[model samples]
Target: MAEKKWPETWQEVNPGCIVFRPGSSRDYHTGTWRAERPIWDNSKCIKCGICYLFCPEGCISEDEEGYFAADLNYCKGCGICAHECWPGAIKMVGEE
Candidate 1:
């Protein structure tokens, strides 16, 4: 896969001032939700490498910053990445 570059801002803000409906599982409601982007808090990461070692598809990589990330093509959104992120650095969050 080619190197994917993220925008300078980590999380983009929603445009409209509409209120977000309560609850976490917004699986169906849609306008432009794309895929589950893996989030990381670099300070929380321990560089333990459990997520990389445990990924069934071997889709995780350690960047120069020492945090792990999943390669999207092979990540089936299994939530295993979230489960195994020991320091809570990696999480599966919806994105558009």
Candidate 2:
């Protein structure tokens, strides 16, 4: 009897359909599909983490400087981060 060999990594698996593995999506960068991008203004940011709370993708993170920054590699540019910013720190700019 022959045994099936499973893929060791997510990238090694077939890409035909969606695979529901917890935290597996982190291995793939979905930001390539974004039409617009978010730009953060540090001067206006209050470090309240409002953008981080509202981001559906959870791509926003804090930097070494104690400021919240978005991971554009995984951000879809949905603008939710910008919309939720009370201090108008995040701005959604068109991708050109």
Q: What is candidate 2's TM-score against the reference?
A: 0.74
TM-score of each: 0.55, 0.74
Q: Which ten residues in a row have the lowest lDDT in candidate 2?
A: 1-10
Error of 2 at 30 (Å): 0.8
Best by lDDT: 2
User: lDDT tens digits, residues 9-93, model 1?
Assistant: 4334334533354542333333223267667677888988888898766767999978777767556566676787877887778
- Model 2, which residues run further than 4 Å from truth? 1-22
lDDT of 2 by residue, 1-96 (tens): 122256546655546644546686676799898999999999998888888888888888988786898888898988998888989988999988
